[model samples]
Target: MTYHETVIIRAMNRSRFTVQQGQAVILAETADDRPLKEPLRDREGKIALSGLSLSELKQFMKSLGEPAFRADQIHSWIYAKWVKSFDEMTNLSADLRNKLNEVACLSALEIATLKVSRDGTRKYLFRLPDGKLVESVLMCFQDRDTLSACVSSQVGCAVGCTFCATGYLGFMRNLSAQEIVDQVLSIQRESGKRVANLVYMGQGEPLLNTEHVIDSIDTMIHSVGIGGRHITVSTSGIIPGIEQLRDENLPVTLALSLHAPDKQTREEVVPITRKYPIPELIKSLKQYVEKTKRRVTIEYVLLKDVTDSEEQARQLADLVRDLHCNINLIPYNPTFAEDGAALYDRPSRDAQVRFKRLAEGSGKTVTIRLERGTDIEAACGQLHNAYKE
Candidate 1:
C-alpha cells in the first residue's frame, strides 16, 4: 500500500470506525473521558454523536439500551437546536444525558486560534482531538449579506497542487463526517448568523473523501437545514470522484479547479492531470452535466504569465466551449515569494480583464471574483495551518 494509505490506516485506528449492518462500532471512552488510549487523546474515544445519522444514532441508543424515539429527540437537540453540550439537551432525561456523556461526545475540534481579515473573513485554526490542526474559512459577503463556510475534508491535502499551501502539508487522513459538519456549526456560532452557503474548498480535495462528504451533505441538508443547492464540492479534477458524485443523487454544485487549460500546463499546475487526463476529465464532466442537469462552475486561477496569457485564455475558452458551465476567474494568491522563485503571483489587472473578456466572448458566463481576505490570508489558495512547531 502507498504511504498515504498507511498513514490513513494508522490514523483511523485511533479515530475512525466502520458501520456493520446498520450498526456503528465506535471506540470506547475512558472513565475520565479523556478519549481512548492516552497516546490518541483525540483520535480514539467516544464517537462524536453529531456525526451519527438518525438511524445510526438509533442503533447507538439501542446499544445503550434506550428506546429508538430517543434518537429523534437527541437528533433534534443536536441538529435543530444546535446545542453545544449535552447539558443543553434538557428534553432528555438526566440519566440518559449522563449515559450519553459516558458513551458519546458532541465535537472534537477545539479552537486553537482564530484570525479575522479586515474584510471580516474569519479563519479558524481548530485543534482536533489527536492534536492535529486544520483550517476553515468563514467568508462574509457583506454586499449580499451571505455567509459561506469553506470547510476542510482532510487534515491536509494529497493532490499536491503546486500553487496551494495545503498541498505541501501532504495527506494525513480524512476528517470524519462530523468534523466536516462541525466546521459550519462552529462558524455559525462565531459569526452569530446563519450560514447561507457551504463550500468544501478549504484544505483538502472533497471528492477524495466521497463517503464522508456525502454523509456530511446528508446531515447538512436533512439535519442542519441547509439546502443541497447551496453546497458546492470543489475538486482538482478527480474523474472517478466526479463520476461517483453523479450517481449520488445530489444536486449540489460541482466546481472544477481547472487552473490550466491543456494537458501539459494542467499537469504542471495540477498533478492529478497525470492520472486523469484533461480529455477523460472533460468526458466525465460532460456526463455529470447530462445526468444532473446542473451547470458546473469552472474555477480558473490566473497565475501571472503562467496561466493568464491571452492565448491560454483563448485555449481555455475553446476547451469548455461545448460544456454547460460558467467560469469563475480567481486571481492567484501567493503563499510566499523568494528572489527568483515565487510560488505564485497574481496576474496584472489587464491580464485579468483580458482573460474574463476572452472567456465571455466564447458565449459562456464569466465572473471575476472579488478577492477577499488577502490581508489575513483567508482568500482562495491562501489558507493553511500556520501554527508551526
Candidate 2:
C-alpha cells in the first residue's frame, strides 16, 4: 500500500524478490526455501541455484524430473569446484547441463578488476548481475599464516558511518546469499589459496541484510568448507542483529565497530548509534557473551585529535574494561569526506601506542592493526563504488 512497497512490487517483476524501503533493503526471511505467498525467483526469472541449500536443490531437481542425488553433484560442482557455468560441470550429462542452463546460473560476479597492494593484499571490484559494483579484499598474513577475506552484504551501505567510504554511496539492494558466498569463491579462484578466515566488514553493514548474510554463513560453513569459528561478523553496533546472531547459535566471532567512547561522540561517528544507544548495546553484548560463551572483539578506530585524545582513550578503556573482549586499535585510514575535505587524520604513532597501552592496562588483549592495500585505496573504510551515468 505504501510507496516503497509499491516500488518493491515493481522491482519483483524484474528480478528475485527483495524487501526494500526507498533505497534501504529490509530483511525478509525464508527458513527452508518453502513457498512464500510471493515466490522468490533469482535474477532474470531464473532460480539462482548457487544460493539453494542441498535439500532445496533436491526439491528443485525433483521438480525438474531429475534424481535427488543430482542436487549433490550440482552442489559439489558449484561450491567446491567453483564452476562459473553449467557448461563447466562436465560430470553432469549434457542433457541435464543444458536443462539447468535454461533455469539456473552458478554465481553473479562477472567483471572483476583486481588491485594488488605492496603488503600482499588483493582487492577486487566485482560487478553484480544488475551492474552494481561491490568490493572484497583478500589478505595473506603470512607471519600469522592466516589468509583472510572480507565480503560485502549489500551493494552500498545505509548506515552511513561518518568515516566509511561506502557510507557516501547511500543504500542499495542487498546481495543474495549466492553473491556473498561467491565473493570468497572468486577470491579463491583468483588467488589459488583457500581463505582461512572470513570477515563481513566490507562496503555495507552485514546485519542490515540479516537473512541473506546468515544464509551465506550457512553455505560457507556447510558447502564452502569454512569453519564458523574462523568467520567474524563485524557490526557497526546493531544491537538487534547482535541479539539475533546470538539466537542463531552460530560459532562465528562478533566484532563491534564501536568507533567512539561515549554517546555524543559515538552518534557523531556512527549515525546508527542514535537509534541503539551504547548502554543498551553493551547490555545486549553482555547477554550475547553470556549465551554464546565467546569473547567479543571491540573495534575502536583511532582518529587523530578526534578520537585519539588521552581522555577518550581512557574513557574507551574504562568503557569495555569489565567486558570480556579483546581490542583492535585501527589507526584511522585517511579518506576524504564526500565534500572532498580531509576531515579526519590517522593518530600519530605515539598516540596509538599510548592508547594501546591504556587498553592493555585494562587486562585486555590489544593490537594496533597493520593495515594493507592503503596505497591502492583498498584498505578498511576505503571501499566505494558508483556506475558512470
lDDT of each: 0.80, 0.79
* lDDT (tens digit, per residue) of candidate 1 on 314-355: 988998999999999999987863353659778888889988
Q: TM-score for candidate 2, please give it.
A: 0.87
lDDT of 2 by residue, 160-236 (tens): 88888899889998987778887888787678788889999998999988877877787788778899899999999
TM-scores of the models, in the given order? 0.86, 0.87
Output the TM-score of candidate 1.
Answer: 0.86
The clash number for model 2 is 0
Can you list the residue pairs that collide in candidate 2? none
Question: What is the clash tally of candidate 1?
Answer: 3
Which regions in candidate 1 have their CA more than 4 angstroms from the true location? Answer: 1-44, 337-341
**Candidate 1 accuracy as lDDT:** 0.80
Residue pairs of candidate 1 with colliding backbone atoms: 14-43, 15-43, 42-129
